[model samples]
Target: MPLPNGYSINAASSDESEDAERLIETVSVPPQCCSARLNLAVLMFFGFSVVYGLRVNLSVAMVAMVNNTDPKPWENHSVVPAACPRSSGAENTSDTFQQPDGVPQYPWDSETQGWLLGAFFFGYLCTQIPGGYLSGHYGGKLFLGLGVLGTAALTVLTPLAARMGSYWLFALRALEGFGEGVTYPAMMAMWARWAPPLERSRLMTLSGSGGNFGAFLALPLTGYICQALGWPAVFYLFGGAGCLWAVFWFSLVSDDPRTHPRISKEEKDYIINAIGPQGTGHGWSVPVLSMLLSVPLWAIIVTQMCANWSYYTLLTSLPSYMNNILHFDLQSNGFLSALPYLGAWLVSTLSGVVADKLIEKKVLSVTNVRKLFTLIGQILPAVFLVLVSYSGCSHILTVTFLTLSTTIGGTSASGVFINQIDIAPRYAGFLLGITNTFGTIPGIVAPIATGYFTEDNTLAGWRKVFWVSAGIGVCGAIVFTIFGSGELQPWAVTEEERAETDKRRSGSISQ
Candidate 1:
């Protein structure tokens, strides 16, 4: 094929010829519409929403799944009042046969409940690195589509597994987690292909907000579904919705613009110019050992772990707290629990916009911007989390604190979450996999710990949980502020690549 005016194809072998062809094809593409990538971002947004929806439905449904009888001996098990006074037939229900409003409860204790909740993360942690590697090498489209599809399939089978008993249910949930674990890495790979440096915060945050949105919707929706139909319906409904979404995802999405049939040439060119070159020359390999030893990467891993500790604590245990401590009924519990994620979604979206604006205006360097928001997200949440511990039984005050904590933490979507991309776009997927594996540990540990500590289900027990979460968040913020970086690491490129980049810069300067 003919090449650009000054550029010539000099290939010594078939492999070199193939590489040269790809490079020319990337640069020679026609102009494409900007909306092509925007549409990709929108699809990613909804994809994450489905992921969290399937993941979190169990949290709300579990409130009704297990027997939530008071741990205290003095409480009259026979005279169980409705979760709230507004419950229908609260007064008319017979004390002998029915407890309060007649919601079904199981005989499972808090510790068993905790283990069930954490099972998903066990399978989740297993697939991170493999998923990232597959996405980077093969393509993100198939893996991302299959991950959600498999989760949906498992979700639809949850009620049956639960009926088979706790072990069966645990195994099922673990498989579901395994499926969902691939999602973040797959999506990070997609972003590595699609997101331009200046627009990374906004695009990544937009997709990430779907998690908050899913949580916001899933809590209330699961509550109402469990109330009207049964807890099983919550599983059936969300699982079916996830399946439906997978169809669209597989049909509509491509791994990158070059592979997308419908993408305009202009948009393709724009993406290529903005994201820089793709592929490494022969002999270039990811410095996995070096990355493992890097201080900044470890800082990100620590902060992610701490952040998820708070996130998972709230995600898994909030509904229980609302029911036990605050005395919210199933419906009320769902609504109240979902409120903070609503604030988080809104704040996350806004933070992305603000982060992009600040960087575009050159008011702050990328590293400082990441550090600034990381501190805000971590510190403010720590403060509010402690306040939540002291809110007593004042429902309004407690809810306010929880909402404020998540709202502030939402800023991390624009902070450390996107910082990995800034430091190394080529390995963004792998780095996300490494950090998220650590992050999932809190998901596994925090719930079990909370269940152990809050077996009494008292304000005091819950306070201990919040205190631990707050302390972890505070420590992470301090370490990240000192060691975290947004600048691209030298190890990301080899000596040959560095020389080529320097040559390009010198050529541009002379022109």
Candidate 2:
């Protein structure tokens, strides 16, 4: 019988399977081959590194910004603004506020700072669905390049915003957030297109490690820039770097191996053959009913949310925390705050390589390997966070435990990110966007909660925040263990979907 799409439905003949195997063998890089793929991986890594470096620069700058200002206290003896003489010392006091020529300054209020920090995620949270859809329809290259360009433009504008005022600063930050919202989904879609099944875990991990590296670089580098040239320079330097990357990206990258002029025909065949049946065609909308009803997807979303809570809390609050609680100078605080991310970058790269090797060796089933790493990622970090919280004021113990926590947390790239590819290679970007949208909700809430919880620098307050993070981590680990799986469910496409796919195929053939 003819297949529904006019292809033969019969099982592949031994001859056909043999032909496919021979083609793959002829085109495939040897087991140790890493040249072309490694080059592509490095390019992608630096792309994400630039994106995240710009994103995190603001956090480091906030440390210096806060320190340079004088604190105000409310007192009954203090004269009101209305009661003070027009030329009184209170009116002319330079210590009360420092308004540099091109730097943005705002009242030194914790709540306002929290709002500035959390506001980016608001735009980030809103754009994932649209970004994923665009990446699916137009291919990742277009949206990915656009995302880079948009963010770079916004980054350049940030310095101007600071010079303009606090309101402008917030507006520019929101725009930057919106532009960056496109990045992950676009990159995820690119992975679906470019990565071989065997190499998916490793490549995704490497891509993710770039973000950690960005965090590592941004803290100290931006801090030094802010210190030397003032905070506005941080935006100008990173923003310029991002713009330069966009130029390189548009010239070098393509959505499919088939279209890339630099990719050899042999490599194209290898990539296409490696991906097998599911890699063709533009992605369709997820079957919302099925995904919503799936207990597994819900569990994954919950686990992602839990993971992000800890991650964003550190990203948003760490520089300030080191300066305040650890009593480090601005330069020292920047260096110390970066240590965790340095550890994270190492752990992320290593875990991905190890996970892929285990799969290649057949030492663990795909599902079990992913689960093993997921548990390690969540549970070990949870334990370390608790330890870090209780380490008293000992700087050495504090840094050690925080480093351990970040290193362990880096394994999520192996577990959660790679599992998206495993479960839905065809729709990996959309599925990831769905879960990431939920995960980023905590990005909004966490910084605000950190602001409120640590308002007084009391030990109890900080302890409470750590406890909540640990509890969330435990719950995420439990949910992932119970429901996360590496296997894809059989497609339950409706008749309409099948028809649409068939029509598209026919149209391609007629062309």
**Which number leads on TM-score?**
1
TM-score for predicted model 2 compared with the true structure: 0.85
Models 1 onward score TM values of 0.87, 0.85
Candidate 1 residue pairs that clash: 30-265, 30-266, 31-265, 31-266, 32-265, 32-266, 32-267, 66-106, 67-106
lDDT of 1 by residue, 246-321 (tens): 8888888888877888887776655756555432111225788889888889989999998899999999899888
Each model's backbone clash number: 9, 0
Clashes by residue pair, model 2: none
Candidate with top lDDT is 1
RMSD of each: 6.6, 8.3
Write one digit per residue (lDDT tens) for candidate 2, span 1-511. 1223332211122243322222222233534254455566776788889988877888878765653334443232242221111223222332333335655454455666777788788878777877876776567887878787798788887756766766777788878888888778877777777787667888888876888998888888976787678777888889889989888888888887777777766676666666654454344656768777866677778899998898888888887676555555556667778899998898889998998777666667667778889899999999988987897666788889888898888987788656766666666677777888898898889989988887765556677778788889888988899898766534423343345446656787999
